[model samples]
Target: VFALVFAVSCENSNVKEEPKKEEFRPLIVRKDGQYIEYYPGHKQIKMKGREDADGNRAGIWKLFSQDGVELSITVYTKGKKDGHIVVRYPNGMPNYVGEYVMDERVGEWKFYAETGELLETIVYDEPTKENK
Candidate 1:
């Protein structure tokens, strides 16, 4: 049959498959030296961060909105979130400022309105420290 003939010809010719111009890529993937990643089905960047050779997140990472606006900035130490953190509203104004101690929120955390007005303040008890 024609199908059998075509299969035999392809095997003997060693024809390679052609690749498409636009290949599909995942929105989020963990790979060494990958510093930028997009959200699902979005063209704009969703997060920006760097990974060590061991595939651990290091240093600072930025999260973005679908509109490509920065929504949060978090610091990482040896793959753990630590240090200061900031989250913003859709308007790009800061929504909150807080600190992370060894991946846990601690100390005073201040929240703000979209208009840069302070809404509330919260103090998280340090989990590592005994409550007085």
Candidate 2:
């Protein structure tokens, strides 16, 4: 009976516990016309952006990685992605730079290596009817 109880306790101890879920609080409104979001426990800034009076995303929006590094910067117009969109590596180096016109990718999109070297440039063509 002693051996059986010890084995049961050992089995329970070996079971992995589920990770606790992190709860995200609401965006803190800033007087500068931007909204800021924070991480659950640390309360570190996760994102900062502005929205139109209609609650649509407008102007430049920046999203951060969990480590608090800027992950991407997207330009929005009236709720659609427009103008330049820049995504960065965790180290804050530009990973990709592309342009969007009225929500569709236009012109050349440049991709970079993690070391900040330009890898390739992909030119986007107008969407054909079949491709659309």
**TM-score of each model, in listed order:** 0.67, 0.67
Q: What value does the lDDT take at residue 15 in candidate 2?
A: 96
What are the candidates' C-alpha RMSDs?
A: 8.4, 9.6
Instruction: Give the lDDT of residue 63 in candidate 2.
Output: 91
Q: Write the per-residue lDDT of candidate 2 for residues 48-86, one digit (tens) a residue.
A: 889888777899999998888889999998888888999
TM-score of 2: 0.67
Q: After superposition, how far is residue 71 of candidate 2 from its true place, in Å?
A: 1.3
Model 2 misplacement above 4 A: 1-33, 127-132
lDDT of 1 by residue, 32-132 (tens): 66678887775798998988777777888999999988999998887877889999999999999988777777889899999999999989876343233
Pairs that clash in candidate 1: none
lDDT of each: 0.84, 0.84
Candidate 1 ranges with C-alpha deviation above 4 Å: 1-21, 29-32, 40-42, 125-132
